[model samples]
Target: MLRSVPSKSQILRYVKGLLITWKLRWRGVDCEGRVVVAGPAPRIWSKGSVKIGNRVLFRTTSRRTSIAVRGDARFEIGEKCFINDGVEIDVWKSVEIGPYCFIGNNTRIADTNYHEIDQGAGPRVDSISIGRNVWLASNVTVLPGVSIGDHSVVAACSVVTKSFPDRSLIAGIPARKIRDIEAADDYIRPG
Candidate 1:
């Protein structure tokens, strides 16, 4: 279902939210509690549904921060999550990001790429789930039926077509597990 046209009140509230979001960042928004950026402020939120938990960071910068969610789509975020700027999540079924996850800039997360190949009746909905503490690099395209396990890192610009097991480092066009992520100096998060 497509999102209902934005109401005048929604527009006003979105502008207001944008200003407040900036101020909050300047003042350092709270990072230890649940927060929600509802009603599609950074981008159009018609038909878009978002759920944020404690300490979740929605967007960093406002440029290219567009999220186009069709009707009947859901975006669910867990605690201590960071979704960088310029990220687009086009949802159909639901996109669930576990706690302590970090989604890099310019990342695209969608349940379905488009309507079924043979038929254009409508886009099918799928769910994208990112386990806890998963780190995704920039320009990654996570397609439908894909899930990344906890403590995993996906290299930049990789197209994920399938799910990867936990504690793995995946990269490349189709996204293969180059190696199981071990102790590292560049990217390391508390257990």
Candidate 2:
């Protein structure tokens, strides 16, 4: 789990993070527990009125470790949220993640497609809201306007383009319900 190694810019970023943490305390950002921010903090943003509760972690150590921030996009994380390595949360609009959500490694969650699909140039954005206890496997790409319900498990390499109901086990390239998770007695976790 080696990163490119923190550069001098990282050293400066570390100092800025210390200041931001202190400032957040003044602004009522609760962290009585801990927020283990991995990588050079420059790769992560703590702005746009972020309200983080206790036990939240942000990490940027993956194949493409880059976090994009635009406008005053907000990100609110609930308590005990575990964001895995290389997970990119691009907030062009707003992205609100609930508590106890375990985001998988290399999963990218972005509000917009980052380009005009029609190529005519028109604004398009839809926020993403991930519910509590949602387990996402590696290489999952959660697109805009998708709201994953609580206890729902998204399999690896799936592309979530739409919302799913609560407690559903979805899989496939575009992501579909294989079967009711309760119907299975031998559920397996992705490696």
Candidate 1 wrong stretches, greater than 4 Å: 1-41, 44-49, 62-64, 119-124, 183-191
List residue ranges in candidate 2 displaced over 4 A.
1-33, 37-42, 59-66, 119-123, 182-191
- What is candidate 2's TM-score against the reference? 0.72
Ten-residue region with minimum lDDT total, candidate 2 = 182-191
Kindly report which residue pairs in candidate 1 clash with one another.
1-71, 3-47, 33-54, 33-55, 34-53, 34-54
State which candidate has the highest lDDT. Answer: 1
lDDT of each: 0.73, 0.72
lDDT of 2 at 132: 72
lDDT of 2 by residue, 1-191 (tens): 88787899778766755665666566545445545566533254545546666756666554434455567787777877777777787888888887777888888999888778776876568999987777888889998899987768899999998999877898987898765555233332232
Q: Candidate 1 residues 1-191, lDDT tens each?
A: 88899999878756665564555444433223434353333553536565556755566445445656567677767787777788888877888888888888899888886866666556655688898789999899999888898889999999999999888999999999999977443343752
RMSD of each: 11.2, 7.9
Q: Candidate 1: minimum summed lDDT over ten consecutive residues — where?
A: 27-36
RMSD of 2: 7.9
Clashing pairs in 2: none
